[model samples]
Target chain A: MKELRWGLLAAGTIAAEFAAGVDESKHGVLEAVAARSGDRAAEFASRFEVPKCYGSYEDLLADPDVDAVYISTPHPLHGAWAIRAAEAGKHILCEKPLTVSVSEAEKVIEAARANDVFLMEAFMYRLHPQIRRLAELISSGAIGEVRAVDVAFSYNFATPRLTDPALGGGGIFDVGCYCTSLARLVSQAATGQDVVEPEEVLGMARLDENGVDEVAFGLLRLPGGVLAQLACGFQLTQDDHIRVYGSQGQLYVPKPAWIHEMRKPKTSQIILTPEGGEPEVIEVEATQGLFAREADHVAAHLADRQAPELTWAETLANLRTLERWRAAVAR
Target chain B: MKELRWGLLAAGTIAAEFAAGVDESKHGVLEAVAARSGDRAAEFASRFEVPKCYGSYEDLLADPDVDAVYISTPHPLHGAWAIRAAEAGKHILCEKPLTVSVSEAEKVIEAARANDVFLMEAFMYRLHPQIRRLAELISSGAIGEVRAVDVAFSYNFATPRLTDPALGGGGIFDVGCYCTSLARLVSQAATGQDVVEPEEVLGMARLDENGVDEVAFGLLRLPGGVLAQLACGFQLTQDDHIRVYGSQGQLYVPKPAWIHEMRKPKTSQIILTPEGGEPEVIEVEATQGLFAREADHVAAHLADRQAPELTWAETLANLRTLERWRAAVAR
Candidate 1:
């Protein structure tokens, strides 16, 4: 059996979940945990039964037993930690949004390239079999040529970090990136390319008093004539469904009303309704749940510099889209 | 029972549907049929058992037995025929999209006002119990404060009348009016007003070779801060849903993957998902069907010279939104 020793960076809630997921992952082990606060690091280490714990991120990065670091800090700090992890010669899996802007994401990508470390944005949903099966279903021409795509990942709760612009926050960075990522994936599946860029990005948002968008909506026209509608916010609870309209049929994920988002549950359902045909429900199961599967995915691709599900290039593209949407909204 | 005799002004498929609806209406009777060809008029009259058959619309308008006429002509001809019908002192039930443009709609409304005749645009869905109950639910704060509304009505088939601009066709005039109408209805319900206007109408479309939108999408910001997303066209088959997102809950119409559109069937469902609660399905049945209920609504409002469900003012407002969307798409 092969194992990739994992060190948890930033002892946050997400890092604790990742430690648990590594326990379930086939090719991963929770070797160490680290946080700026020594108490938090010790608490996480005790809870996860890790062999090592560190008060500083540098200690975790410098650990010889750790082959990879899962970066789950606030997006504002993701780039710095990921760069340090890369320079430390450890495989890096950073949280989504990568950074606040495209330039920062580019810098992080360059650092990863210069360090020659395995890197993948922690868009965990993309690595799940449910979404992989989605790409396969779309590419198989089951729904025909995709024309329109709609994705929403909005909720009603607002966290201090989510609404703080200085912390690389707001709806777009918080939940909207998931939407653009899904839209690009649909484009990738529809065009049979590695990825497709948006030709047009039109956005409208309701900004709070601090100039941070509380709710944001965007329409992206991809190169293949696909129009994707994205809605994300901290003020509204939407159905949060992924709807793909194709030339010959349509595909919808999850079920009637609930959304998958962070919860793929035991089985994921994709309803394919063909033109003049009945809806076919395709279900894909994640044996170890979404987070575990994501951890395993990183371990499986440790030998490679990037993940097939979400690559560094795609991460840069997704950041470009989020920036364009924000600029459009601000305009 | 009081009877408002109906003379269908066009021997078209929609006219036949209206004639059938009139048979089931409470205060309506099918009395006459009119078409350019006398044979077509006679055939429609005989098939529907209409006593009066006229070759010209003017002749049927002149028939004293016809108390009100259902103008089922293409939208390009709706204004002229509705004006003539009012001039001949006949109450009128015109089809959806009362006129090609807002100016045309206003002119027809002016004519109807000058003649002091009963006139209503036949948006049958508005007359159904399903939509009326939706208004009550929203007004009752069942879904809390409305923030976003999404409505789509799209189909794949492109008829000659739909593609020809001169005939008052294209997706905007053909089906997009319904989207705008639903948007206004939600706005009205949310604001507790008879109707509300859009503050901004931003639209994008995929124009065909003939400069007609094969598929159109719109984002409308209402006066009360509700953003509505509308999609309509002849190039795709959308779920054709009416989704309302509120501060505390969300409402989705029809069921799973199907849209009500013209088919109210026996019962219509509105799924209200309260925040942190299970979805509640509210079913409202229209015993007389959608079109028949529309006919009965007009029959019940003939003496008032207006309909409470959809007034000429709201019709004008809806048309203005559609025109603005089209102009935005063009720009």
Candidate 2:
């Protein structure tokens, strides 16, 4: 069994979660932890029992023992750091909204390809078993032809990274990308395509005092007339359930937007209700943490450089869609 | 105690439910049944044990003993019959989407006012105790500042009045009106107003072959930046849950759009989830059918000539909002 040595870049909340989850990974080990703040990096390293700690991301990327880097920096920093990590000959698992714009994401992908490094966007929820089950149900026509998907991923958190435009913070970038990705994934599964792009995207937002979206709504009309509606926010709390409406039934997935893989592992549910029939609750009991599963998935596909389930094309497309939605809100 | 004499008009499925509900009403009785089809009228009258049966609407309107008429005809016929009913000195309980057009609904109200007859739109769900509690909760700010209201009222039933544009069928009129009205109501309750019209209404639809919207989505930007998103369809089945997303919490109401007032009633829940808090379920156990409660509400307010809960002005505004949504779908 090949063990993937993981380097944590930016000792933030998500990085800590990933570090904790990687501790339980079957083929991944936390090798180094780095951040702009040495105190945070040392604290994270000491807490996670990592052998190496660095005050800068470059040092972590340059470490010979580190095979892959998990980039958890704030939005604007992800693109540059991922590019640097790839140039350093390290595989990269970057946090989502892959980059602030399509060009940045494209550049990141281009760099990864040039360096021949494994690259995967960190959408941990997509790697969850529940999402796979949902896709299977959709493909099996259990919900009939998918007609509409409604998703909400929002909270009242006014985190600095989510409220400042310069940092690439907003509802669309911070959380709405989850909605866009899942919606496109549903369309792909329903149509039996690897991925599907929305034919039209419409969006609206309520901007905060800082000129970033505090709350936003977007509509995606996919090929074959599937409409996916997304609502995300940085200033308000919402029921973060994902619903798929179909010709014959409806499927409900609960709190799916941001599942920290290491949350003590609990059983989740996907509720399916056929038209004029009783509800059938499909339970998903996972044996591994979400980040652990995601890390293992990336490790298994490291040789291929891209995970089959969430390919580079899909990640870049999702970033483009999310940015399009954000720009459309202003228009 | 004053007893209200009810005349059944059009003898449709809704009319049948209304008649059965009036049987359990404290202050109303079904006095006559009328339909274009004499057989339906006769059979309805016999089944409900009404003393009078009329083959034509005019005959039933001429029955001097009938104090009120429950107009349950299809969308296109509501205005004309309500006007005639008012002229014949009967209080009017017209079915939803009061008329296909705003002008028609206005005329119906005008006639009712001119004849000094009580008039109300039969939005039975609004008259339900559960709705009252929901309004109270909003007014009490139990969920903090209301930020968004998301509603879906859809089923895969393609009945004539829901699929045929000639009869004023479509998603907006057949079912989406409920979404608009409830969304508006949530706004009003949050803002502490009698009724608050949306500042902006944006809509999109997937039309079926009959030139009617089979599925539709609408966005209502109400006063104070509250957004109400509605998804309604005739060609699909949705979760049909009403969610009120707020600054501090979210509330969920199930199957709220269309409640058959006369069905075997069960306890319904209103799930309130405060941010970072466990969900608290509020149960509503009604002693009367939905129609029965609505009839009693109307009977109590007959002296006022308009039901306070669903005023004539609110009804007219809801129709206008629904039409605007439908029209925007095309533009």
The model with the greatest DockQ is 1
lDDT by residue for model 1 (B270-326), tens: 899998899998877757656777888887888888998888888888888888989
Cα TM-score per model = 0.93, 0.93
Per-residue error (Å), model 1, residue A214: 3.1
The residue pairs found clashing in candidate 1 are none
The worst-scoring run of ten residues by lDDT in candidate 1 chain B lies at B255-264
Per-residue lDDT of model 2, residues A1-331, tens digit only: 6999999999989898898889888999999999898888999899989889999887887799999999988888889999999999999999986788889889999999999999999988887888889999999999888898988887788877787789987888888888999899899999998878888887777887777988888888887678888898887677677989888888988757265335557688899999889999999888888888888998999999999888999997887788788887773
Model 1 chain A lowest lDDT segment of ten: A255-264
Q: Which residue ranges in model 1 land beyond 4 Å of their true spot?
A: A255-265, B255-265
Evaluate candidate 1 and give its CAPRI docking class based on DockQ. medium
